[model samples]
Target: MDLSRQRCRLWKELVLVASLLALGICQASGQIDINPDSLIGVETYRTRLVLENVTSDSQQNGPMFTGRESVLKTGDLHIRGSQLNDTGNYTVRVDAINGTQRATGWLKIQELEIPGISVNATSVVEDIDSVAAICYTNDTNVMWYVNSAPVSSNNRMTISPDTKTLIIQRIERFDSPLQCSIEIIPEIFGRSELIQLTVAYGPYGMTLTSMPNHLSGVVSAEIGTPVEMKCTAYSRPESQYRWFHNGSLLSFSGENISLPSLTWDQMGSYRCVVGNSVTQLTFYQRLQVQVPWRPKPAQKRVFTVSGSYVVVLIVVTVLGGVVFCATLIYILFKHYSTRTNRLI
Candidate 1:
């Protein structure tokens, strides 16, 4: 009788345990809830769902929820779906089985609006200051971006107060192609077609040369006497050539420059420098002037020898004549005297 009583107590305890397990299973399976029936202006909407335990007071463990490899939790579960063109309801189901119990939720989708913005100026003079206008299709608040950086009026940039346009006051740098983009915010989705700006700071090069190859002689020479120098130069920007004589500016006329009549002072190393606002180039040459030298006769020697030498020569000649005459006469007298003595 005692053994039968013990067996009956054991059976009652097993039945109670089985009933408690069944109740726990029902409590573990819960319901889910999501707010906002529909969503708008979003490419994809994330819907959060809350799961509440209806029967149980303690938490239960099971396999975590998933959607196409995306993890979903019990409470505050996020669901996402594709709505490329169609905007309508998207159903998200959460399958949980704890002794046969399951739950699901739903969300709605909508479309958003974007704005438009573009650049006006395409090409501009290089180095000098220029302006590019950023305009919006519907005259909305816009921002300016030059090569991907936001610019406000500083040393080299100026943005208009309205924010619809940007005026680049000075382009002190960058010689290559520059890109300007405009972004308009708010209701409209805006993007600018790239306005390629070509900054051209004109080509600059200069060449200097002498009209007639520079050498130590008369260049722009006269027929007989004075020597002159001519210098010429060529350049894209029409270079101005200044003739330098021993490092001093030599004045000239027209593009064909001419130095003053060459003198001993002007004869030295000469060079022609060609330059403009853009570039400077120089050509060098050596110059020398030649003049003949003739000596003058002595006036003092001509006057002193004129009378004295002539008188002295005449006197000597006259004296010799007189001496010869006297000699002849003496001879004749001697002969006559001798004859007289003989006759006596």
Candidate 2:
């Protein structure tokens, strides 16, 4: 009886060991995870496993691939230094106790180079000069931008067949700081240096304003009063200004002018001529200036009453003088008569 019990215990221990070994062999053939893409000179790990006698079509006993063990007892295929020629499909196989399992993947290695841009001219005249710009890159994926916004073919602009060159028949001043970029993927990209464009524009929309505004195209002010005028126009390189009076050019040339004291000689039709040298464009504005004639000084005034009071005073003076003369004559006549009668 003792011998039989010992035999049964030995058999049970052997079966338990075999079952544990089978479970370990099944766990060793776990799923594989790999990086599909990598950059040149970068280290890449293709897979992680603990399977027995692992092999891959990408690895042919070369020094480029080295094997390492992870903390979880997982085997890893390590690429020491990736190269441009090492881009292709890869297949890995593992020999397990159950059967031969396989996992396949693709690896793409790329070499990135700096991008550049070239242009025919940096400065151009608006509506007269055309511009061409080209991007330099080995990549076929190209994109263009103007002022940080994407650009496309339009009536005034066109793109080349390969989308590497951009042409503008009539470049405007508002379009500047062009840029080009290569998009390898959503996460990988390269950009070129910004190229600025200088466009010379016009001298249009001319306006002349006075400090004391004019009424009905006429500037009226009193003699000896100061007047000021300012002229302005829209331009790229700053417009040149000239002043004219009565169809004759003045000695002064600027955007603003002041007449210290307005006079007859300084009054007439005033004009402001604005011109651009680069674009060879011109504009002008006109206004009439009039100085009113000054009036003369008045004579001194005397204190006097109304016409009716003057008439009353003259009549009263005449009556008083007549009464006094009549009284004196009467008294003299009476004296003469008394003397004569006494003598008789």
The TM-score obtained by model 2 is 0.56
Worst 10 residues of 2 by lDDT: 6-15
Reference-based lDDT, residue 184, model 2:
52
Clashing pairs in 2: 49-75
Please report the candidate that would top lDDT against the real structure. 2
- For each candidate in turn, give its C-alpha RMSD to the true structure in angstroms: 23.0, 18.2
Regions of model 1 farther than 4 Å from truth: 1-84, 98-120, 172-190, 202-344
lDDT of every predicted structure (CA atoms): 0.45, 0.67
Top of the candidates by TM-score: 2
Model 1, 1-344: lDDT tens per residue? 12112111111111111222544332344443334433342334443444455332222322422231132333333346524342333333332344433343333333322333444455554455476666554445555566655556677666677766666755433522333333322342344544555543333343333544434343443334344455445443555556666777766634444444545665455665555444333444445333433478866544456788899989999999999999999999999999999999
After the best TM-score superposition of candidate 1, give how far the Cα of residue 249 lies from its true spot, in angstroms.
Answer: 22
User: Tens-digit lDDT track for model 2 on 4-92?
Assistant: 12111111111111221344432333454333422222123222222233322111233322333111223334343444444544444
